[model samples]
Target: MKRIITVESVTEGHPDKLADLISDSVLDECLAQDKRSRVACEVMLTKGKVLIAGEITTTAKVNYIEVAKATIREVGYETEDIDFECRIHTQSPDIKHGVDNPLEIRNKENTIEKDIYDMLGAGDQGIVYGYAVNETQNLMPLCVNMANAITERLTFWRKNKTVKGLMPDGKSQVSLSYDGDQLSGIVSIIVSTQHIAETDLNELREQIKSRLINDVFPEYDLSRTEILINTAGSFICGGFDADTGLTGRKTQVDTYGGIARFGGGAFSGKDPSKVDRSGAYMARYIARQVVTKGFAAACEIAISYAIGKAQPTALDVVVFGECKLSVAQIKQYIIENFDLRPAAIIATLDLYNQKYKPTAAGGHFGRPGFFWET
Candidate 1:
């Protein structure tokens, strides 16, 4: 018997995603102004409230509250529907370690700076996996593709007013059946959406079925595939009003969607110095290169680090038993060809100055036009 795999995605306006967006927006702003800024920011949202907290070291002075509010408004939330204003509760403290120099001269001006930029020290020690498979054209799993298609369509319809009265918050789940190793058919699709209270459920379902679902999966047999939209009832109030949200809670959604193992580190609210963020990006870049170069049918790269260390403790490669080269050879190639240090990865990928807010939703790894390429 063939097995089935399922993956899910959330809309950009989903509460958790909203929080991620806010955090990344702040990160991008700081990095845009000060390329060397050290920042770790977190965002929390609830009914009528937004809370900004975390440590930051930057030369740029930002109106953090304005930044938060603007991010919320841009995501389709207005001041009228449960005001999403923010309050900053804390600021980062100065590091007191004396082993490193405290003052340096740049452009003939003396300044207090952290000069440890060779290998970004791990903000916290953990593991992370970067995966790429030839199962799809983009090297992503099919189930995730279906989920992203549905979520993107939802956003598209809302922006174009093709589906009027549609709220921003939504969720999509796709179950794909595979025979042996090849994709067979879609098993089911589930969409939970928020809409204006006055909208008719039956009409909304029909519109979604025709405009969103049918458009994305044209070859799939919808008559046999189970479709559910807001199966419980109407969703009048959503976004931050419907539930509370915190940064870094949607790690699975942000990465490979549970199709592969996770490293238990959140990507948002941390600077590139944290290997949890930069290391993962580097791993994905390497994995993609490995698969694109025809070294393997699929690749999962793992790198482990120690706190305040300049080098990863362990570097590994798993090809799902589909590699033309031996695992040791693949690992040797990566170690020889790529810079695995945290700071090096950050610099190579240009993570310090890249805008990351756009990647907070719709899946981060598979998206085209990443800043690293530019």
Candidate 2:
């Protein structure tokens, strides 16, 4: 029984990705100045305008407009052609009270700060999903891995002048055929890239098919695969002007790309204190470990949290009938082996002292340099 699966990735200059870029740039700046910064930022972009609106609590003194402009410029957007509007608000003190100090009890038995675990709580009530598979070397679905690799290459080419006339905006999709548990072959590939008007697109297509696509998949024979590039001609108008964008709009692109269920939230622009980001990373970490330990060939795990709770409210682990251990046993192993608390997740992942800009553009999962991938 042969089945097909598809996954996709978009470049940094894609409209929504541009929004994510600006949001995470702010996140990175805040983390650089204060690791404890709590940010829940959302960005919107349209023709000639950038709107930044969100709650942020940080000691960092930042030039918000400059940060947005720098991020836009880095993504190949002509920053001088745009106007910026910012409506940032300080984080609500009520929420900060719980997130910063947590619930404390006095003198029950000399409640000391040394036992911080007792007071730590999740930043918000939400659910996060983590998934892993043995299909690829990186324990990622083959289609997603290939799709991201294709677009990452496009970015490299554009930035280094390897692909002349190639603009930063682009998207890639890879569809893989599967027979039972094994991947069969590539079914199709599609790449739509923005470009300057004068470039010969026909020459660009040949270059990509011969070099960009073929070079990325040395192990796979895709010479006869169905491929398409820029179905619409003259991609001169792209980025925010072509389409309006909002932060968190690319949730599926950020995660598994329709391969697995989402926890119904996005990751960028939020600090590690936001369980929407930290919990998802922790869940992925645990899921990957299950496969690495030889307990399963694939795993999908869910971690749920309730407001003002230090620990996970519930956990669901599915091994996809490929594991020797039962679900309960796997759950037990995770409980005994890992700390699912919000604070513990942050410390274990080192997310606070990290950069998020890279993650804002490319798909978050199935990528290197992220702790969740390891």
Candidate 3:
């Protein structure tokens, strides 16, 4: 079967990504001061203002307004007339009780012996999925990897002034042609970038082709790929000045880029205690290990948890095509070799100690330094 698969990515300066960055920044600050902080911060950004609102149980004493402004400045929006508003409160005691003592322990129904690792419970109940493919070196779908690379290049050029007149906000979309199940080649590439008023469209297009694309994808043969640069003609106005941004708006970009399913739980702004974040990372770790160990060419793992429960309610492993080991065997392997509990995942991945602001913009999966990627 011949088909086309497309994936898109946005630069860190994009409105939604900016909001995500701010939220993750707050999360990072909380974790830095107190390793046991519980943060679930959210942000909304629009013209001349940034609002921070969420439930947090941290003794970090962060100046929310100052942090938001500093993030805006670092993102190259110093000239904007942005003001900060904060409405933060501590986490509810109802949720805190569930998190502190799991349902099993509270009910006295725990079948197995309890330990310190089993004391902490899931912050909430939800399903999370993790996926990986062999098409790219990072075990990610090819189009998404390409799209992310293009947006990353745009950010690099804007910051380094490699391409004159480049601005922070930009987007990239890549389409790949597939013959049956195998990738044939790149079908097309689209780039929309913000620039200064003095920049010429013709020159910008030429520079994008000769410098940006060429530098980023030198190995790929793109002679026949339909390259579209700034299809809307101009993007002079961008960021909060032109549009509104809210946290968790770019969930697809944060994970598998539509190559697989997400459980509708956002990753940023939450601590590892939240099963939505920790379980997802653990799922990805399991899926990646399955593919890397040759059990499957592509893998997706789904783990579902119950609020106030320290154990997962369900576990499923889906693989594309044939597998060397039976699905039941693989499940058993995971049980014996890995621990899927929320607290154990946090320890295994070292989630509390990691800086999450970097994961806010770029696609979280397939990135090398993250422990889950290992």
Candidate 4:
């Protein structure tokens, strides 16, 4: 029997995206003012209340409430009909310890006070994975690429006002049927979009089908495609109003869209000191280089670090049975060519800068160029 694969994506206006935007925005602010700042902020959103919580150690002063409100307003949730109003609450204080300074920093710097006031380490210790596949031209899988394209076009039309009555909150899911190793056809397309209260559903569906969907996938015959719009009816009240959102909830979307295994670590709202964030970025960088250099059909790299430790406790590379070189050789190449240390990854990826917000939406790894560089 042929296998069917699917991938899903959410629009920038979705509640989860809003929370990610706010979290990254806070990160950006701190990094903009102080590159050495350590931050791990998470945001929760519900109707009229945006709760900001997390730990941070930075010389930069950040107005968390301001960032939250601006993010919501930017997503087009300023209407009175919406239940959420972007009001912020206090950050969680429990996770604040390591953000202040870890033991290694204290031992190296001579005192906790000096370490806290000087350098900072990862907020936590954990494993993270980065992956890449040759199934698509962009080094991403087809289903995920299509889903991201939908969300990207939706945002583009909304920002340009080309699609009037389109609200910010939306989602896209694409299921592709694969016969052996080759893609056969699209199995389904699911989209849940919010719109103005008075908009016509039929017309809205037709517009999305004709303009965005049809234009993007012209090679495929969409007559057999299962296109669904707002399967649960009108999505008038969405964003933080309809559902609560938190940072790192969309980790799968942020990475490979379930096409690969996840390390179960969330990337948003955490500083580069955390291996969960930095190691993941480094892993992706390594995987991309591996695939680009013709070493594998797909690659997933994993790395784990101990708290306050510069060297990773564990490191491994998997090629999904498509290795051109031995896995051990790939591992050796990574060890020799890349720096897995938390501080080193940040410096290499330039993660200490204010570029987290743009990554909140869209697939992070498959994008054209580094937004941080731009």
Which candidate gets the maximum lDDT versus the true structure? 3
RMSD of 4: 4.0
Clashes per model (N, Cα, C within 3 A)? 2, 0, 0, 7
TM-score of each: 0.90, 0.95, 0.97, 0.88
Candidate 2's TM-score:
0.95
Lowest-scoring 10 consecutive residues by lDDT in candidate 3?
Answer: 108-117
The C-alpha stretches of model 2 lying farther than 4 A from their native spots are 101-114
Error of 2 at 199 (Å): 0.9
lDDT (0 to 1) per candidate: 0.79, 0.85, 0.89, 0.77
Residue 126 lDDT in candidate 2 = 96
Q: Which stretches of candidate 1 lie over 4 Å from their true place?
A: 80-119, 372-374
Badly placed stretches (over 4 Å) of model 3 are 109-113
Model 2: residue 68 alpha-carbon error in angstroms: 0.5
47-150 per-residue lDDT for model 2 (tens digits)? 99999989998899988889999988878888777889999999888787666555432222464444565466678889999988887788877788888898
Clashing pairs in 3: none
* Candidate 4, residue 172: lDDT: 93
Weakest lDDT window of 10 consecutive positions for candidate 4: 82-91
